[model samples]
Target: MSRDGTGVPHSGGAAYLGMPAFPRAAETATRDDRLRANLRHATHTIRAKRARAVAELDDWARLRQAGAAIKDRTLRHLDHHLVRLEEAVTRAGGTVHWAADAAEANRIVTDLVRATGEREVVKVKSMATQEIGLNEALAEAGIRAYETDLAELIVQLGDDLPSHILVPAIHRNRGEIRDIFRDRMASWGRPAPEGLTDRPAELAEAARRHLREKFLRAKVGLSGANFMVAETGTLVVVESEGNGRMCLTLPETLISVVGIEKTVPTWRDLEVFLQLLPRSSTAERMNPYTSMWTGTADGDGPRVFHLVLLDNGRTDTLADEVGRQALRCIRCSACLNVCPVYERAGGHAYGSPYPGPIGAILTPQLRGLASPLEESLPYASSLCGACFEVCPVAIDIPEVLVHLRERVVEGGEVTIRGTRTTIKPAKRHTAERAAMRAARWTFDHPGALRRGQWILSRSRRLRPRRLPGPGRAWTDTRELPAVPAESFRDWWARTRGGTA
Candidate 1:
């Protein structure tokens, strides 16, 4: 990890740091017709398959409600559940570590790997590790982390960022992946086969051959869990590929970095997520590989296990009543599949490991709206509510987006670095606030509103089809609504023959 001039530490190649705000990034992405095409094709296909998969379950809505309720209940007593989980893991011969932030989490993982004396560790496509930039942190510590998941491997080999949640390299076509494999696989480990083509089976075969060597040779494995059972200290990872299973079982030392919100009270709570996750994410009735481990076993799996429970702003997010609901997210990426804005803007535009509707609300809350990048995330959505409809955990993303927008437009007290401080609204939103205030005043006074409407009616012909000055951007893609010849009040009074 390296610090910028502001003394702020960044990792994972600082992929998202100093990024332009969402609107600007989105504008640039919209111009990339190729990127837009890739996103549209991929998201549409996944959403259609998911819709059919979801329709198969008659009690899906009930399951969704149950999942949401379970998450909420666990969050309500999170401290208790965490303590219980730690005790359970300890009893099961696993060491549990708590990290207050990303830096701490990275340090713990690095030290654990260093102690194992392994220079390279195989990974299980864990998002929690990505969130904290663990791969970059390990590299800084002279430890190499190899991505075993095929999409992640492609992204790593190509020197690119993940654009989608479930499928990180969603922006890349089969041809691009083949090219990446042919050119870059040798440097990483195994070389691509001679005359490699873009066929899906061929790509999978090359990735498998390349990763199999790393999996067999590595002594340490790194992972993130989809759900952690508090009662039994078992961690669960669901995946379509067998790479996760290999990472979990093949290595002698295993380390899992997981968000604190992943904890559930019992195994019964786990069953709901299992049903909802696979169908929502991969459109499968169940994942091909469902790996679970409860610490260690005698002469089986990893001999040593370390569980790093990461906070990293989750407690702060919990303080917010409206924003806390984002913690219920299961990382299914169903929202991303259904989001129209994400299809057009692409995941790179959001500038986070998480993309699409879930990212719009989750990123801002987890990091706080401290910078332009974080502040811009809340406005990334179009509020079509498709995200909420498809969410397995029933997170109301649009509601949170609107809430965060209010936070950006009218700054308020927020907890930063454990300090309570009030943040002022951004200077960019001053004109917007002024416009809203003027409209509010006009609506409050009946005579003022009547006069304003009468003036607008009389000057209807003079009104420009497009707005001028700072407002021109709003009208560039949308026509200004034409003014009517008379106000609704006039029509009502004239027809009723009373107030006139």
Candidate 2:
């Protein structure tokens, strides 16, 4: 179990543990040609579209600031806002359930669906559901939850975890998808109608036909919301595919599982987020399907609406001053498209529902930084600031990454079999720490740094392409810099034609 400050034993987030550091995982991912090609093509295409979409908005900066401010204000009084939302939901004929953790949340949803005596439930693409592993929990309870979102359906059919937030199957190309649809679609339900080709329309038709059965037949529909309005107790979901519209409205029992952080103080606050989220996420001017329900409307959608306000390690994250900003994520995969690390390594390597720069900080925070895998996530970034630049809410992801790394190093005391002991900072990173400390000391004393530089220049010939000890493995994979005979100080002196 990964331990952060919460001291809660995490059982579900085990996927992000006991893995190699970023460099190793990235190396493995980069070698896979299919994965690389898939990621490169998807990211580049999305990035271009996102840039154009953002450019169209004249008040994008203002909208971004407004989104951030509203979130910050909501978070400041989150307890108050949540209570208000609960009241609004109940008044509007909805049952609101609070989940303290992932297990509780899954249990509530499972029981809710079980009460309806339905073995199969259809799902819209909801990150909150994935975060809590709702499908796995449902399966354990003798129920099967089907993902109806096109990308989610592909990921589900492939028996693979989501690699990208928006396009979960971004790691899969058209060929891979066609293969999945042809082979896997039949077993689930409404198999490909005769000959299903790789063409976009054919694929859409196959999926539409397949999902239409679930939409019409299923008793329960599960979804996650983009925002929850405290003022009106309305949950909003903006989607490209009309499938979300169907799921939200068609089911007899509609269950929405949402993160606590995805709340707004008022309906007006949604105005800002609506503008920011679509452009930042799908690169769309307006989402094709915008579904907002104030609890249950009479003679309209689902008569029974269940809203699960899920904590699931969110309070722990909120406790972090630096990391709490991660909750500001509208899940606009804009950061994923621009992240160099994600482009090369893809999303599966992060081993969480969330991926890319946001995932690096978010997974570690939610799951805690006790395991090697969680610890490695913080170091996954190049600190290029590209993610921050593109962020609609302006979350400083690099700052959070650095902050979490410091926490990992400093806050590693754990009781092993009742004996409290401090696990030394990751064994591999000790040399890095030592080197950094030495550099810091030299930099602090200019005279010592100058002398060290001169000595390094004199002993340039002694430098090896590969370093000794554990560092040798690092150098073996990377280029060693060629030490110059003359140091920067000497070069500057020569340029000036003067010497001490």
Could you say which candidate leads in TM-score?
1
Writing each residue's lDDT as its tens digit, candidate 1 over 1-500 gives 44322122234354577777888888887777667777777877887789789879877867887899999999999999999999999999999999999999999999999999889999999888988989989999999999999999987887777889999989889988999899999998889999999999999999999999898898999999999999999999999889999999999999999999999999889889999999999999998989888999999899999999999888888888889999999999999987878887888788888899999998888888878989889889866556876889989897788778777887887776566778899778977666546655765687996786577666766768778899997544343222334444565457532222
lDDT of 2 by residue, 1-500 (tens): 34211121223332333456566767777767668777877887888788899889777766776788888888888999999999999999999999988899999999999999999998989998898888888989999988989999987787666778999889888888898899998898888867667898888888888888788887899999999999999999989888888889989999999999998999889889888988888888997989999989989989999999998778778777768899889998899988878987888778787989999999877876657778789889876557876889989887788677665654554333224455567655665565545555765787996786677666756767678898976543333223335554565467532321
Model 2 bad stretches (over 4 Å): 1-21, 412-427, 434-500
Against the true structure, candidate 1 reaches a TM-score of 0.85
Best model number under lDDT: 1
For all candidates, the clash counts are 0, 0
